[model samples]
Target: MENRPDKTNKNNRTMKEKIRFYIILTLILVTGILIIQTILKPIPQGITGVQTLETGKQQSTQNSITGLGFLQPQDIHQIDTCIGDLSSTGAINPGDTVELKQDIYVGSTDCLNIDIANITLDCKHHKIIGNSSSSANGIVSNKTNDATVKGIIRNCHFYNFTNKTSIYTGKPIVLKEGAKYFLIHNNTFNVTRGITLNKTIDVTIANNTFANYSTLLTLYTDAEIYINGNLTNQTNETTIYNNTFEGIGISTNKPYAIYAIYANDLTIQGNTILTSNQITLDGVHDFYLKENALSRVEIKSQSSNTTAGRIERNTYIDTSTAMHFTSFSPNELSNISIYKHDMVNFSLSTMGSGVEQIKIYNNTFAGPMSIDLGSANNCTIWNNTFYPDEQTQITTGPNSKVRNNRIQNGIFKTITVTGDNTTVENNIFTKITGRGIVVKANNATVRNNTFNNITGIAIIIGDDTWQPPSHPVNVNGTTVYNNTIYLWVNLTTNTTMHSLLTGLPAIPGASTGIMIMPNTNNTNISENNINEQNIYAQTPPNMLKAETRGIFGKGINATYTLENLWIHDNTINTIREGITVENCQTTHIWNNNITKAGKTGIKTENCRGTRVNNNILEGGTYSPNIILWYKTGIEIFKSRAEIIQNNKIDKYHTGVYIYNATNTTSINSTINQTQIGIFSFLSMNNKILNSTITTRHIGINLLKTNHTQVNNSNIRNETGYLNTTGIQLSLSFY
Candidate 1:
């Protein structure tokens, strides 16, 4: 039974093999047919870089359709071929049409007539003097309002394009007002100054090569147009993308380039800008562009709602940052937008003035920080990259949100915020100068930052006030809170103002480490680390003030009125002036650690309503441990009313310089250190109650003042000169 089954299987295999052989034979026949047919067809060649007859070929052009295939060679003459004046045929008479059957040559500044280049035919309506060859333009239209010349002389073979003998004199097709619907295409030009036209009526110029143009094609902003498929090079932002750019330079030093001024809704897009100068635009509105390259660009201000202007997805690579803006005339436009761009390698060292708010986001700046914001405002700077060693990293000014950016390790300060109302958060300031953060303005929130191994001073506040105190940029409210600053002490050569106060002089009786800011009736500071190494800063001699000036209503002519300042709950380990307030009025300092402070915790002068309560002021020897120097702090040099209550003042040369006070009170406080705790002098109406005073010298002493009352208190540790009475009062008080 098995042998019979095997025989049947063999028969089945034979039948399958026979079918397979037949199918293979059929496939081979089909393949041969395709191969033979392909071989029989002729291949068309490309004409992109070729020229046909060098001289005139009295031949006829056989019109054929070879387009959309391998770009084929067309019959085009490369040399000049024209004799006798085509004009002498007849004075361009009315209704007379001039037509060339084959390609004609154009000469430099060649004239069709003494006055008019081409004939203004038959004083006619609907007259089109068609061009003969692929090139023909040496014509002009005069006394012609509505006219049309057709065909193209562009992207053609190279001919004598010297001495302005370009498609120069006029357009292979040019139109004037009332001249409607003109079509010009596919022309090549190499001229001193290329094609140009303006104040022309509706026209279309497409697929032309304005190459090696010492000065290329230009359509002054005045002309209304549709421009496409054109290649322009070596010029400013004059190559209008889709719309036409007014033809420029009729041979003048006046910069032979395109001008788009006072033009309404001239759309520009998909064009390349390769220039070192910025495009100058005035009175232009409703413009839009996408995916173009600009060396440097600028946008001026105009009437509000800078409407419908979008430069989206464009790439900018300015080597010199040559493009900038100035408000010679004011522009108050609304809706200006710049989004999704890649900008890199720019030398933006000179954008020096008037910049307005434009929505710029999702941009890449792999260059320097040259986009200065010294005078720009209300902007959104998000998702940008500032590569290391770039030139222009950060410029001046304020009210901007420059967050979520990655600016890598560089030699200088990566970003400097010198303006007001700016929020700098969630940014990585890595490998920067030890100086972590720098400020020259007021009313700012510096929070949640990472100063990665920055060797410079981490945090630097440019208050410029020392003894008394000075203001930041303006008298405005500012806050420095919740930041991790690491001040790295590197470069033994450059010493920093590690713990220094740059506010107004600590005016006796006033405040310190603070400013008299505007818009803020009072200032506020809280929850900060003063000893973080990232706070390693450098002393910029540029920030050095001229010299010293007096406090409020004193030698300073400016009226200083600071009321109700609150500074509380901050961890200040070591800083020059834990807090320095000068020539200010009314303050509150509560619950802060002045431990191991480089200077006094609270320093104020020429101020009033001063409350210094519940603070630990200690450990500052090289500097005054706790110095109330120069007529202020619980003392009235010029102002009055203060309560220095419940504080631990330790390790100070002179605890308090309570002098020139109109009214003062010190209650329930512990003073233990060298010299004295409460030293009063030249003050009035002073009262001390229920305080423990133990010092190396007389505990509570006074000098030259009035109404001094020292009540019952713990006074024991008298280490220095017991002969020095515990309570030394002036004769006036006695």
Candidate 2:
């Protein structure tokens, strides 16, 4: 009877605890039921929901459908058998996707014809194999004249269509007229021809690999065509970017990786092309070609205008002709700019007329090149560096400017300006083996140029040939001023063999500073510093065939004469001849300082109305190694109406030698430190007045001269030899 009262209380407490445990169990069971229901129930499309499945894996239920349960028979058409004819199944409708189950073999006519819009054909990595006798395509759209058919064909393998009898034979895909908004991607084409898009619009072909095809893709009359990351061939309002082109075509005669004809608004960029051919553009305008690695590029305008383009920062490697611009007619081709390019073994050739406003700057050329601006106007070439192994030529047009360029180790004429109103200034020419700058135009100003270690003529003015009808167009009104010409004849020994083997003209050991060619008129050569250095002869005597002079003005053989030439305030040092004027008329040479001349300081032959005034002509000590055949300070031969006045002539074999001259006068001139002071041979009517002549042998020696008078002159013989005479007249005719 002791625990009987506590038994009731214990029972009541246990009952309450049992109620709480039952409630907890019921809640747990309801939560498990709700989770199972959520996992099994379907989720709405594109709505995010989390659920744990029976496999204990959490997954997002947003637009997630597993298995093939959701595919309707009308939406997905399975291709189990080979297609022989397309008319049996009618056209593929919109929102339909055809899946390839097995490899299909097609007949010769039509495999799958599509004339409807918004259809997709996926091959599921199965090949569409064609028979050798078949000329059918894997997919083709019929011609919709005024209507557009949009479709997509992807993940298809086209193989072994070997028939090439016709142009359309062996083509895998053909999009006919009025096809728009079609996407062809991730396909492999191994047939004879890949795809053809004719009159298509807004087509994108990407991520396709084409191998061993005649042409990977051909586009005709298509606009807004975007090609990216594909290996294909030949586009307007077109973009060709990030594509790799291997070869040109099946036939080796085809030389274009991509050819666009009558295209407009094209953008070609980021292409890596490996072919011996070029990318060609014909009748194209408003183009941008940038950031490409290409072999060559060609632009041609025929019956249309190609205007306003840019070619920037593209690399050309191991190509022969990098860029070529041509026009069939004069059609105002204008506004082209090319800058910041790295070129190797390349050139630029622009031909035909009506080309204007071109700019080329900041390019580095490693190998030899030729930049020809044929008949182009208003062009600018600046800040280019050239390291050429062979001959390099840069020819400019009218109103062109070539400034601030550095030419290193060029073998031939570096720059040539044949157009009028051209300016060549501030150019640095170093180690040039041939002529540096050649100007054959009128009204040219070549100033502030530095030529160092040149082996040939530093600057040449006037034409070399006068092939009749192109008569020697005089280099009239030309000024060559403030030029620094330093010719190092010692550096030209190795170049002789190269010149001889290539049949190039030999560069003279005694190179010319400036050469004014025959019939040059009104030329002014002033303030030039020419240093020849009197370099020794390293080649054979027979091979040394160049006439050396510091400044030479030449004329045709008494027919065409150089007129109105002025050479003043120039300094010449260690040269063969300081200045040589031949067959010139009305020439004035004044205030020049010449030193260490190996031969005549100032020589004029067959000149008329010549004046040599206030010049210092000094010859160095005679060396037996040098060929001193004509070591005279002032030599005048066969000249008429010549005046030699107020000149200081010294350190020569003969101070003044006048031969076969008429009406010659030497007044107020000082001649000293010579063997013979004033020597005349076969001269007539020459007057020597108010002159000081000091020599060791003879003062005034006249042989076979007529009517020569010597008045008011002082004569002194320093050596005082046994037969020294002040005024000896021998064989005087009158």
Candidate 3:
């Protein structure tokens, strides 16, 4: 009321105020509309929009995903979706690419069921986790019988998933029925069951990790990789390369790391598996498993075709049993080669039904090896090495060969031959506690083998009923030639050759350099050097025995006789008898040089039709424990129909002692420097013809004997003793 005098001026000022208020309101409305329009606008297609860029990430407009998700570089559709949304959307279309954005929490429902082909699902390093108690799977393919899904699934991380099915289902990633030509690579799986393939072909699994974790608690996680293919539809051309499997617990239900059945042309290369489970293969053919670090391998391939299988360049570490092979049925398995393996602590076992041409070469065993290849024909083991303080047992089958192997520091182990026509050649055995080689089969040849410091028998040719009662047949037609046996003796106790021969035993266990036992016939032992005189200078003795022989041809009893033995061209220097053949018939002992024989040399007792010719017996200091009757150059006791010809006997107590022998002839023989020459005791129909006998005491002696003749013989006794005679006959009729 005070300012009501100027109405026009007040009205004009009010109008100006109203105009300013309208302008402010209009500006606020325009700003709000602009903000709404900017927020509501759709992002452009074929472009990836990000508010902020990461360190190694770049803004791109080509709609392509990288890092194991590169299907087609240009036509790649990078779908930024979670793992749960892919399952909700049923099936990813063909030629579509889906990249997960966040970690997916899986429930009882399956995560991804791929039904279409040519799809790429990249998890992008996010974990697809299951509920701690759920029986859900991470990813599964189509279950149809004729659907072929060809796709690439890469860069996934799956954890805490457990399966409910009993038959290799509901795994972390499963390709089933007709899932073929797929690539699954660069995935990380933890605390979950691994991948499974059923009746698939041309699938490659590379650079994946299947590990066990302790954080999640679940059930029914059995095998790491299980591939099942039946007879009608077999899986083919599967490759698993450059993968790692760690801390995989063995399942008592189905304990295996990689189990395959009826698969062909498979390759498992460059893998590191650290578990106690087995890599079992059944009904597989034409495969290569190379360059792997494994624990165990069991093969039961039923392949009959001539295509080959190979397991090469593998390292087995810290396992009890490394490899086992069995059940190749119907026809023989063709050409399996196992070479270049390094076994830390393991055993290899094999059972042969239909297996042939199995070659094991260039391997090293750091511990003990128990190899039992049962009756496998044409098997070869060559160029292998066995380490110290370990035992090894190798049993060969028919037509098998063991060559060029170095087995050292063994504790009571041997290579046994059980089948026919086996050959053991060029092997080096050092510091062995048992027999170096045992022959129990027919036509087996042991040649060019060197035995050094063996505590037991160097080579034994016997039938069944030996220590190991598994041999079924008698040994026949066996030839052991060109073998060098050096028995070590104690150097500290042996100051002279006399002390070395008497004090310490050369061969331990009272064993011989070559022993031929009962039921062994048609044997040939030739060109062998037994118990070298200088063995003690090289190695010291570890043990002692009662006696040692160079070559012993033994028999069971008087009823069972060893027949048809030919022992020739052997050089034996031992502490006891050299070349003793007892209870034998139709035997030939010829051209042997017995040097440093402490007792009798070339002894034949209870034998018939024996021929000993061209033998050189050079005796040394007698054994203090042996009796006087046993210290002879050539002993023929209780034998008949014998022919001893062209033998050179020297430096013995008695040369040619014949006891209880009949129809024996010593023709063209020479005796030198002996105490008694041609001493015949209780012998009948014996003749010494064309013989030159020289003795220190008696030249020719006959005691309690009849029908003895000395024709064209030169007998000389050169001694100063009182009762020295050139020829003495006492209590005998001639």
Candidate 4:
């Protein structure tokens, strides 16, 4: 059996070994060829294409892709190639085209399956009519993990995808599972639904028209261009430009024009959109919206990530809101800039607690426009013009700033700041009929503002009446500085009878320039210039006259004794009192120059520890002959612990009338051209020390007073009036 090891078996074994070796060699050669082919093949980058012009000549094209808010266009290589026409539904390969010759009716299946990459489907303006199939679509591109499909859909019309029988997902075109670099241009959609993009990237929908017909009963809640994304594959770099969306024959419950969810980096520019609803961005980031004429825009994000964007050069017409922002968490929507927008019949609002750092500038809001910052923090509004038909209202939240704005015409009612640490500066309010700025917050500052021809009060701090402790009183640390107010009534149009009939005050600045209410502590009013002209040719009969003040402070029914008030360095030319403090404590009025004071320059009633020092008061032809006895320099009525020092008063009936006041001191003061200087009536412990009183009548007149001392003073009748006495005492104890 060991003889030569069976020669036939050996020969068969050798043949088997050779066959195995040849098979292995063939596989190796095939694999080597495939590897070489893969290495030498060109890698496809972004959209590279050649566009044919009207002359039928091809040219290389590099198109710009739109991005998220306020971004410029980015150029990329693009391709636009067309193959022969095919009229049926089938799979399309790379470099293949499906061009429709006539209208095709789709039933239960998709018209074209774009499973492969780099394909074009042109319908040549023919319609793809869907007949009530829930899943039927005109074109479908479905890709998987790590795979991309590039598609172009142009010159097509989609109709009747209403899905009346079942759930309505029967869109015209559906791109899913990471479809990238798609260009959809020159298309028309007339259906209840439009195109849908799921998990797509680098897609642009331009030069298209989307409309709803009369046969459409209700539009779907999804937008015309509905974009959706997930956590892993976010929809990025999508642009909708040069498009037209018309919600024809639809009024109520109108769908959105473009609604994106969980998307990133979007550009919506150069589109004319007319819809009753909104263009919503939900959970989106990095958006640029410019040069678009639309109805409304809403940015709402509930995700943990930040939503930041820019909206500029846009026009919104016939809508209730031009822009609205909403968020769920703290600081979720931030760093949004809005500028250069023209809105008609629109409003801007931030209706979220999580919005911050918003900047709005260089915008024009015409007629019936308002701004409401609801619970948003750190917002800024500047350099805008507001022209309202009836009223203009602006409201802000905490740490907000409003500056350099022109609020003119219409009512111009109020700018309400309802939060702490807010600033309103450099704003111009002209031709207004109501109050200018109302600050209901702590640490608020109103500075460098101009109020011209305002018929009502300029600034109001804190509440006029008493409120509960739950809603605590604000304006504790408020400051009003460097503001100019010019108030006048038009005598040519308004009569004193009309003013009296309308309950208007007889004196100018009757509503006051700056009004301080009760419980307003630590308030500073300085460096303000207020001029009010109450010039009338004739006086109305039986009209009630009231004292109007430039800076007025008062207490209400429940709360009294306003403390720590500092009013200094103010120039007031009004028809009544310059500074008045009633039922207040620790009030300071210094360095104030007051002219044309009809009644009193500085009046303090029921006040304690009030100091009026270094003030110049001049009554310039303001005393009417009927009410000449009502004019005075410093009237301290029912007040105690008052100090009137270093004051210059001239042309008044009485210089310092301390009536029913106690513990008062008038020191180092000068009074000239007055009827009675330092008239103390029914007062106790009053001292007139080291003062000069040069008057036409009595200098120091005391009636029914006790412990009154006039020491180190010069009292003279410089006017040489008849029966003028230097010191006249009647029923007094000294």
Candidate 5:
């Protein structure tokens, strides 16, 4: 502005001065924008520091630099790339090496053609790496074998850019077989291809960045192939390495890392892959994947994939398990040798899931609540350490042989029943929070097992703690037998939480020790030592469910029946309910020690044809156990005919209460308790015979019941609820 050039004086300056001014202005504006944007869109505060970038430069040139229509013939006479004319360079002769200088611009239809032989039109490779300023690309040489040129061109960038052409087809720097020893090295390829070695061999394409090229690969599309799958013969001994791939073709797809079809003597190592898709595809024939550490590598299977490749000692770490692999066709046409590996460890404390074929023989685990397993094949587990965090360890589907395993400081429960026909024999299951063995499966043999320091809520009243969810996902028939279970609910809900303890009664954690829903039937229990007071202090016994609702709304009086149930030989030290048969038919309960009961021994509501016989009923002497017959005239939601036979009953309060179940038959069972021995309210068709009774109250009292036969039975009391009469006869049943 100070000394503005006059209109006439501006003509004195040379044209070079104007061009230099424009270039300087462009650089100034770029520098200003870089400074302003750097402030306005400030750099992000990463964990460490800002990432550093690397940079380099390259220059390319070709022969025949000068044209035939040169205004000054002498200034641009030489064939050096220093000349700048192509159309007028005249035809190339045999043995002529065409050198492409740094500035050789070709128009859309303009191509360098050669009809001569023994010519070398080469592109000496120059690299524009990912560490370069932005995504950079350079040059391409398509058809140069038969003549016009011979010689190498180095340091020319190769990229599929459209500085001149506007077509959507990406620009490619090609090299056909006619070109040999085409030393193409040190080039950066991003969003473009460097040199597609088609029908070419002995090519060296190294130290290049094929960056973000395989971007549009789809489920059915196989893009980003460095060379054609069928053209491996072109680059038989090719070498590709030290490249970082971060395109969609690299995402979750493991086959795009390094692909060499039928290629020989290939080596790939030291590559880092960080794709959101967790996998990269790498294919090689007799290939080597050594030191090629991957976040995730996917091995693919081809239609005619029969060659067994080698996979040796590659470390893979996946945090989210997003890393995946596909069988090389079928079952991988190969086997991999992993010297050492690690599965990402996390807290697996959540319980009650359905898993499969997981063998936990003799290993220390962090936390896995419910793990299902298949039949063990020649696998034996002995002397291992187990620590539980949930109420149950395993739920279903396995045949695990666990013997002599050291279980220490566990929580909730050690194992649970989830699947069908499994065997758990001779395992020490002791922990705090839940019962040692919680049965929820069918045909399960639980024998020779010891349980200590278990987790049970209370003793006096059952079901005082938290109950199970009403809606069960997968619950079926189960058999419980011959295992010592020591429960200590006083510790806490489970092992995960030790400071906060739930001191409720009635074995709080799960709804019922064994819940039988509609889909669950034909269940049996025998010979298991289940102690519940070690967990909860002075806990009450629960007769049925801790808290019943919904499907439990159908709990004791459910319309659905649990058929073919056999409850026998179970030593119930303290529990909510011993033999609770609800909506079941033809249930047989026999020879179970209902001593030291928590709430009650046997409870049957809406049950039909139940036979209970031959059991020692002792120190339940403190609690008044009731056997209420909730039978109705209607067949639906009603119970029928229950027989209590030949058992030494010793308890407090009372013996059996038959209510509404009119046709119940009680025979051959001894009774000795505090209050009444046998009391009936609207019960009928019962036979009381050959049984001794000793109690503080009535011997036999019938209130609104009939059709019973009493013979060969010794009964002595203070007139047996004399209010009813000396020999009472009532008609409640027709």
Candidate 6:
């Protein structure tokens, strides 16, 4: 063109080379339309463009294809198999996090069959091993109505496995029904049967460590199980706190560590159970068993309606029976409360008839206890501290109240009241061998008690050879008041003072402070204070038997009749017969104050309308030479309409003694230093009026007499010896 710039600049250099060839053809057609728009853009749903090629082969690249692609070759061979490699059975979705590095030997039947929900099976502490061929379960979820399977199973280690198919089948972890919000924390179970919740809902099994399981935990009809901290076991609003159950009950025959059935609102607190036998509750409702360290506890209610049950502060060891309340129908077990326990080899049994309001308070017992309120009504056993070995019975409950108890070393009959309006008040019975308080029922009340070293009968009302005196089980209006009975007798035992001195058919020693036998009607032995010390009269291969007595009323073969009986204001000491009435009727031995009478100080036999009034007999006879074997200070036999008034007898062999008595009457009595003072035998229409007799031998003695009357008598002989007498008649009539 320069030649044409000469030529017109060579046509403008061919138009600047045709404008550089149309700008190189417009940058090659805009780089071929940006490589065909990056080859048609779109690839993302669980990712794919296939490129993982480090040698495990898979390459389809375009440049930005991130992972989990190639149609999931078994989820990329289980993410290259190693970290909790569960490759056989699947389906763990919705934000899954399955982490368990080793130990996993599930032999089928359910190693892990938790269907599909918001999963997280982090058994990071490994072990989910189980293989007993088929009836197995390591971690299961049946999913009944579908609570949408929510989950979290942490630090797991479940072992063994044996579910012989019956007895609710050996479980290792089963959440049935509508499985919801499950969180089984820090697990470590040595399974034979541990954890089973049927009908589940929002469960939380915390800090678990259940060993050698038989039934470490089981709850049928489950609702809200929130078991806290280490070891576990309960239902419908359950809360088991601080658990530690170590069982050897061999995995279920009847071996229960905790087996709650048909539960309602159960709460078991601070557990430390080492089981071999029982801890079962059937048809449980509103239960709260606190501070436990148990061996036995059974509460069975057949049809529900079990109300507010509470077993408090427990610590029972080596138990045969610590707690048992069984009901099959009726009201189905009502409100129960057992408080502050510390029992050892204890016993408590309540059966059927829908047990009512029960309250066993402040307990601390060691060894024997047999409390059976079979037909329980409003029961209350107060402030207990019993150390009974044998007869520790508190049976028959109605409006029961065994008050303020502290019974120690009891062998038999510590508290036996057949229960009508039962109230054994303020008790403190020590070292009893038998009978401290035995009221056969009927408005019962033995008040303010304190009996020490009792061998038998400190208070025994009615038992005329065991109740059936012509169909009269009457211990009517029974009340033995203000008691304080002490029978030392040098701690008693010539075989128990010869069995209280030869007891059988009548008495050698039935050891009585208060013993009202027969039908015992309107009975009331008032203000008692009996103290018997070293009462001696024992020639026991035969003889020496004067019916050892101290306030005793007998009538066994006479077809029972001890009516309107009231022995009043008693203070008897060193006795061997001080107030003894036989077939009593309208009997009232009044204002008693007798001391050291080893034989008789108010004795009546075959009594009629008897009354020995204003008594004050002192230091009489201990069988002084046994003549007619008379050791008397007012003794009447075959009595009828008898009344010995204003008595004051001192140092006697015989004073006011009547035999075969008929219309007997000894008025205004005062006899002192007597061998015999006003003594009538074979008496018919007797009367010793205004008596003031003093004698060492005989002041007024009548033998084999009839129609006797010694009027306005004041006879004294002060024993000048050699047949001394102021008036002595033999085989005569006056």
Please give, for residues 245-285, the per-residue lDDT of candidate 2 as tens digits. 55435454544555655555666787666655467766566
The local lDDT score (0 to 100) that residue 505 gets in candidate 3 is 37
Report the error of model 3 at residue 640, Å: 2.8
Model 6 / residue 224 / CA error / Å:
9.4
Summarize candidate 6's per-residue lDDT along 155-221 as a digit string, tens digits.
Answer: 7777766444443343567777666666666677776566776656556555566666443333321
Q: Give the TM-score of candidate 3.
A: 0.79
Per-residue lDDT of candidate 1, residues 176-285 (tens digit): 32322322344444332234333333334444443333342343321122111111211111224432222223322332223344434544565444443234443445
User: Against the hidden reference, what TM-scores do the models get?
Assistant: 0.57, 0.73, 0.79, 0.82, 0.50, 0.41
* RMSD of each predicted structure: 14.2, 9.0, 11.2, 11.5, 20.6, 20.0
lDDT at residue 398 of model 6 (Cα atoms):
66
**Which pairs of residues have clashing backbones in candidate 2?**
none
Candidate 1 or 3, higher lDDT?
3
lDDT of 5 by residue, 1-734 (tens): 65666754676566668889999999999999989977885333431211212112222243232221111111121121211122234433333444443333333431333233323344344222221222221233344454332233334454434222322333334445454444443444454233444444444544555455454443321323244334234344444455455443443433344444434444455554444332332333444454544554443434223123333344443333322223332322222221222222211211112212223343443343333332212123345456645433543344544466655555555555444566666777555443345444455555677756544311101111223534333334455567666554433232322111121243334323333444345666677656654423224433332321100101323444456777778776554444465667777778877555444556677878888788665544253345322211101113577777886776635566566674566677677643666666666666767767765556666667767666776665533443322233454443
Q: Candidate 6, clashing residue pairs?
A: 1-10, 4-7, 4-8, 5-9, 214-251, 500-509, 501-508, 501-509
* Global lDDT of model 1: 0.46
Give one clash count per candidate, in the order shown: 101, 0, 0, 12, 84, 8
Q: Worst 10-residue stretch by lDDT in candidate 6?
A: 68-77
Global lDDT scores for all candidate models = 0.46, 0.72, 0.74, 0.74, 0.44, 0.67
- Over all chains combined, what TM-score does candidate 2 have? 0.73
Worst 10 residues of 2 by lDDT: 221-230
